[model samples]
Structure formats: structure tokens, C-alpha cells
Target: MDTCYGTPNRKIVLLTCNVDDMTGEEIGFAREIMMKSGAMEFYTIPVQMKKSRPGFEIRVVSKPGDADNMAALLLKHTSTFGVRMQELSAYALERRSQVIHTPFGDVRRVIGEGYGVLKEKLENDDVCAYAEKAGVDRKTAERQIYALLEAEKQER
Candidate 1:
């Protein structure tokens, strides 16, 4: 089987640390901060720590050059004493966005193409807003937009 993505084009670092002390709101704030500070991706996974305590591991993907900065941010924002870093190779799709004009309005869609695979996804928020203004449900709006895209594709 052929893969949908091409070979890794970027070298990134994964920074992680386990913290059992912060509240949910605090973690959310830290996540926001990380995103704003140039973290490519930030997430948390629940885990059990020592003494049978529940904790979450903060995982951040960042550019290799920013690994130290990201780790410092994690240390300053979280209760963890230290952050771990691992370099990784990433394979990603090349993506672009287009606005399709329809009866409802202009709807934005993200197109990703790589290794002969093409995929498109409509923005949910745009669909929802248009649906409300057009007095239709989300599903109806989405269906109409997709149908229009399909017809355009067929014409081309």
C-alpha cells in the first residue's frame, strides 16, 4: 500500500514532563501560553505517578531550535521540576486553504496534498455560522457545500 504522506521534512523535538499538582484551569492556561509561544502542538495525557497519585503528562512539539525555550516555559509554568526532550522526525501533509463561494456564502476549506493523496475539510465554525444565518442545520449546510464542491470538481 502507498502512503499518503511524503518523507519527513522537518526535525522537531518533543518536550514532556509529568505534573500532579496543578488544577485543570492552570493546565489550560499553560497550554494556551505554549501555543502562543510557538509550540507546534501541545497536549496532555493522563497518567499515574508515584504514591498512586493521578497526574498528567504535558507533551509539546517544537522546532529543534526552540526546544530549550519550550522546556523553560514548561518548567516555569508547571510544577514539574524538569522537562524531558526527544528529537523526532515528522512527516506532514502540505496544506492550503481556499474559500468556496456558495449560495450560503464563502466557506473555507483546508486542502492537504502529499504523496498523491489529496484531502479537503471544511471549517466547522464557518459551516455553523452559515447554517444559523441561512436557518438550516449544520448537516444541511455541510451537505450543500460538499455537493457544490463535488459539482465543481466534476466540471473541472
Candidate 2:
């Protein structure tokens, strides 16, 4: 992929296809396959197709180098006969991961900063582990962890 000089981070490719014959489970499996094939984004949009049949328009974004593999996976895993690909430049935030210490356990937090703003979130796997160990739901565990972080900020 060519380096983009604009606000976007880099150049990428978008692959799209339309299909209506796959079941929900099949779509899920196709999504997993595309993700494993290094697709940066895999999503579907519902559309009304010919003869009033409902179908899904699958869209996948990938690095230019991975577009061929992503397209191949989509062709192999989905009900579509052909895939369309387009090159695009995309914006992305700078991101990093940190281990957050809590009373229950250590959680991996993903921190993103860019364009004069910053955001943080605990990794889902870590949150799930924390929830199980602390005997709380995921949302509750997240709240508690954020509360602890806020308290720590207040102290310092």
C-alpha cells in the first residue's frame, strides 16, 4: 500500500460482494474466515435485492497486500460468485496496550490517542477474565475497574 500524506494513516483496499443464499451461521463463519485472513474490517449491510429478496452486502477492508487473500477467503467461504475491490486511504488512531492493576487482577487496557483526543478501554478478554474471577457481570466489572482507575487518578 502507498503511504498516504493526508490525515489518514495509510492506504488500504475494500472488497465487497452481495449474497443471499447463506444462513446466519454461514455468514458468521465467513466473517471469522475473513478476519483470520487479515481483513481489517468485515461487516454486512442488509439490502433489498432483485425480486424483492433480502440479501446482505458484505464489505471487507484490508491492507493492499492482504486484499487478494481476503477476497479469496470471501469467495471460498461465502455464497458470492465474484468480489469487487477498491483502493482507499483510511484514518486510524495511534494505539497502545497497557496492563492495569486492580484489586481483582491485572487487565489489559487499550489506549488510543490522536487528533487532540485520547480514549481508553479494557480488553474484552481481560474484562471477561476479571468478571469471572470477581463474580460479577462484564458491565459491572468494567464499572468497578474504571472506578478504581478514577480513584487512583484522584489520589495522584
Whole-model Cα lDDT of every candidate shown, in order: 0.92, 0.89
Give lDDT: candidate 1, residue 36. 98
The residue-by-residue lDDT of candidate 1 on 29-103, one tens digit each, is 999999999999999999999999999999999999998889999999999999999999977778999999987
Q: Tens digit of lDDT per residue, candidate 2, span 1-156?
A: 555344987799999999988999999999988887788889999999888999999999999999888888999999999999999986777899888898778999999877666888889988999999999999999999898888989999
TM accuracy, model 2: 0.86
| Residue 23 of model 1, lDDT score | 100
lDDT of 2 at 136: 97
lDDT accuracy of residue 123 in candidate 1: 98
For candidate 2, list the clashing residue pairs, or say none: none
- Candidate No. with top lDDT: 1
Badly placed stretches (over 4 Å) of model 1 are 1-6, 154-156
- Flag clash pairs in model 1: none
